[model samples]
Target chain A: MTGVEGYMYPNEIRLYWSVLIVLYPYITGLVAGAFILASLERIFRVEAVKPTYRLALLTAMAFLLDAPLPLLFHLGHPERAWEMYFTPHKTSAMAMFGYVYLWYLMAVLTFEIWLDYRRDIVLRSQQTKGILRVIYKIMTLGSSNISERALNIDERVGWLVTLIGIPSAFLLHGYVGFIFGSLKSNPWWDSPLMPVVFIFSAMVSGIAAVMLFYMLLTKMRHKTIDMRCVDAIAMYMFYIFIIDFSLEMLDLVHRIYEANESFRSLNFLVHTKLYFSQIILQILIGTITPLVLLFITQVVKLPEIARKRMYTVSGILALIGIFAMRWNVVIGGQLFSKSFLGYTSYKIHLVTREGLLVALGLTMLPLIFLWILLKLLPPWEDEGAHAPAAGD
Target chain B: MNGFKDIEHLFRFAGLFVIAILVFLVVRGFIVPKSFGEYGHYRAAAIPQIAALPLHYAGHQACISCHSDIQAVKSKGMHAGVNCEACHGALEKHVLDPINVVPVKLNTAVLCVRCHAASAAKPKSFPQVNAAEHANGIACETCHNPHSPAIDAGGTK
Candidate 1:
C-alpha cells in the first residue's frame, strides 16, 4: 500500500481538518442566523422589521439552499451521499445532518417561506412579466388574490412554522457543535459547551449579516435607514456575544481545570497558531469591544449616526470574529495529532475547489440570491407590509 | 377595493381547497403492510431470480478432507467466519469441471475497506471518509485477522 503522500502531494492530505469543519460551522451559522432574522418580527413583534422579514426569510432559504452543497462536494463519492438514509444502521452524528437539513428545508424553511409568499404570489402573478410571472404563477399555484381570511391563515401558519423553526434552527447548528463535541478524541472540541457556543455565535453572525445587508441595501435604495431595526439587531448581537463569550470562557476554564496529558501541546498550539485569533480578534475586538460599545449605546443612547457606525462596524467584526472562531475550532483541533506524539500544520490553499476562493464564492451566492429574491418579492409592498407573520 | 376584496375571498377559498387536497394526500400517505405471500405474488410475476436454483458451496469439509492442516492454519480470524468457498468464489465449477476455474485473489485491504469505509461506521474523530491514516499504507489483514477476528490478534511475537 502506498503512503498517503503529505507535503509533496497537498491534495492527498485529505484529512487535515482545515476546510471541512469550517464549512460545517459556516453552513450551520447561516441556518441559525437566517432563522434569527425571521424571528425579529415574529418573536419580538418589530413592525419596522416588516421590510426585512421576507428578505430575511429569503436570505435564510437561499443560504440554506446551498447549505448541503459543501457536504456533497466534500463527500468522496458525492453520488452515493443519498445512500445515507437507505442505510441508517451506519448512522453517526454527521449522518444526522442529512435528516436535519431535509427537515429544515422541507418542513420549516421551505414551508414557512411558501406560506408567507403564497398570498404575495397571488397578488403579484398578474402584474409581473416573462419568466418571473411564470415563476409567480407556479409558486402561487395559480392563485392571484390575497383574501383577509387567507392572510389570517397564513399569519397563523407562518407563526407556527416560525416557532417550530426556532428549535430546529438550534438543532441544525447545535448538532454541528454536537458532532465536534461528540468526538472525545479531540480535546479542543469535546466540551459540552461546544453546541451552545456555536448556536450563540451563529446568532451573532446572523444578526450581523442582517445589519450589513440592511445598511448596504438601504444605502443603495437611498431609503431612510431604520435606526430602530439596526439598533435592535445590534442590541441582540451584543447580548448573544456576551453569552457566547462567557460560554467560550467556560469551555477554556473546563479544559484548564482538567489539564489532561494533551494540555501542553494544545496550549502551545493555541498560544502560537491561535493566540492572535482567540486573544485579539475573538476576545478584544470581537467580544469585549463590541460588548462595551453596544452596552454604552444601549445605556447612554448614542446619537443615531454614532449608533449606526457602532452597529455596522461591530456587526462586521462580529461576523469576522465568528468566522475566526470557526477557523480555530476546525483547523485548531487538527493541529494536534491523536497520537499526541507531534504536531502537524494545516496550510490553506488559495485555489483548490475546497479552498478560500470556493468558500468565498459559496458565501456570495446567497447574497446574490437575496438580491434577486428582494426584487421578485419586494417586502415593502402593501401586501408585503401586512403580510401575515410566520404561524398566523 | 370591495370588488378586489371579493376576488381575494374567492382566491382564499380556492387556496383552502388546494390545501385540503394536499392535506388529504399527506394523511393518506401511510403504506399498509401486506403479507409475504402477497409480496411473493408480485415477486413471482416480475422476478427472474425465482427460476434460478440456489448455489451451494461444496463443503469446507471436503476441502478439509484433502487440505485439513492448511484449513486449520488459516482458520484463525477473518477466515474463521468465512468458508473456503466464499473467497474461492463458488468452487462448484472447480469441483465438478475440475479443469478451468480459478480461485479469486483476496486483496485484504480491498475487502476490509468495503466495510470500514466512512459510509460503514462514521468515525467522528477523522474528518474524511475512509480515513487517510488507514488508507495510507496499513493493509486490512495487518490490523485484522480474516479467519476468526475474535481469536486472531495483530501478528506479534
Candidate 2:
C-alpha cells in the first residue's frame, strides 16, 4: 500500500515480471544486432566493415550465451525450464523460445563461428601443446583439413549460414518484441510497431557494443584501431538509430492522438512515475545525446582521435539509451494496473533470486564470456598466422 | 575427388549434429504428458494435479462441521455467499489438526473494512462505511457480529 497510489486490483500489487525480464530482451537484442552486423560483411559483401566481422560474431555468441540466463534466473522453477522444449505448447509465444534459442545457438551462431574458424582452430590445435591443445582438438571435432579446397568449402558454407543467420537474428529479437507487443491487455506494450522498433534498436545497440569493444580491444592490444570499420559501423548505427527513434516516436504520437480511455492513466504514468526513466534518461540524455554525437561525426571531418572519442561517447550513450528503452518497456508497462485506474511502484531487491546483484552479475557475465571467446578464437585476422598460444 | 575427401569430416560433423537433434526430439516426445494438448495448449494432467493439491481454504463444509452455530447465523446473513476463509485466512491445517494449528484472530476493523471501505468505485448497493468516521478507534466486532455483519449485535452467536 505504501507504493500503491490508488485502488489496484488485489493481484496487480506485485509485478510478475522483474528487471530480469527487461535484461532478457536487452541481451537478446544485442545478440541479434551483433549477428546482423557480422552478416553485413559476410552476406552483404561490405568489405570496409570486414575488420569488425569476426568480432561481431564472437560478441553475438557471448551475449547469446548470456541471453537465456536471465529467463532461467527469473523462473520460479529453473529446473522445469526444459519442459518448454519437452512439452511445448503450440499457442504460447514464450513456449517457442526454447526451440528458437537452440536453433540460433547451434544451427546458426555456433555453426557459423566454427565453420569460419575451422582452419584457425586446427592450426591452433597443432601449434599449441598441453590442456588447451586437447581442448582445441576436441573443438576441431577430428577435422584437421585446412587445405585450399577445404577452406573454400568452409567459406561457402559459412556464407550460406550467415544468409540464414540474418533472418534468424530478426526472428530472435522480433519475437521478443512480439511477446510484449501482442499483450492487448496492456496498452503500454500493445503496438504493431513494437517488433520493427525492437529489431532496429537491437541493431543500434549491438553495433554500438561491437564498436566500443573494437576500439577498447585494439587499444589494449596496442594496435591501430581500424578507422574505416568504425566509421562504417557508426554510419550504420546513425541511420538505424534514426529509424528506431522514428518508430518509437510514431508509436508515442499515435498513442497520444488516439487518446483512448486508457490514455489518461498511461499519460499520467509516463509523466509522473516514468518521468525520469522514460523522458529524462531514455529520450533526452540517452537517445538524443548519442544521436547528436554520431551525427556530428557524420558531417564534420574531425581528427582521428576526436572521431574516436566521439564514437566512444556515442556508443556508450546508445547502449545506455537502448537499455533504458527496455527498462521503460518492461517496468513501465507493469507500473499501472490493467484496470487503468491505479498505479504501483517497483522496489528492486538486493539479495533475492532476481535481485540487483544478480542482474549486475548476469550483465557482466557476457563480457567474461566474450573475453574467453576472444582468447579461444582471436578475431584478429593478422594474428591467424602467429596465433596466440592457447590460454594466452 | 580430393576436395571431397578434405571436407568429408565437415559432413560427418553435420551428420552428428542432425542425429543429436533427432535423439533429443525423440526423448522429448516420450517425456511429454500423454494427456497434453487434449483440451488446450497445456498439459491436461496439470488440471487434476492442481485440483488435487491440499485444499488450503477449507471449503465451507469443513468449517461448518465444527462451527455449526456460526454457519446457521451466517447462512441467513448478507455475507452468506462469502466463505469463512475470505476473511479468516486459510484454515486447512487448523481444520485437520486443531491442537497444533490455530485459526487467526483477525482485527475486526481491518478485516471487515476491506470490503466495506468507503470507495466511489465500490457499488452503491453494497454496504459501505468509513472506518475512521463510523467506528473511529472502535473495533467492527464491538457493534456487529462478523458472521452476520448485517445484524448489529454486541456478541457472536
| Winner by lDDT | 2
Per-chain TM-score of chain A in candidate 2 equals 0.97
Tens-digit per-residue lDDT, A225-252, candidate 1: 8887777777777787888889998888
Best by TM-score: 2
**Each candidate: fraction of true contacts kept?**
0.08, 0.54
Q: Note each model's CA RMSD in angstroms.
A: 9.3, 4.3
Please, what are the lDDT tens digits per residue for candidate 1 over residues B66-106?
Answer: 66665666775445656776655567666665557656668
- Given candidate 2, what's the lDDT at residue A207? 96
Docking class of 2: acceptable
Give the 10-residue window scoring lowest on summed lDDT in candidate 1 chain A.
A1-10
Q: State the local distance difference test value for candidate 1.
A: 0.71
Q: What is the TM-score of chain B alone in each candidate?
A: 0.43, 0.72
Which 10 consecutive positions of candidate 2 chain B have the poorest summed lDDT?
B148-157
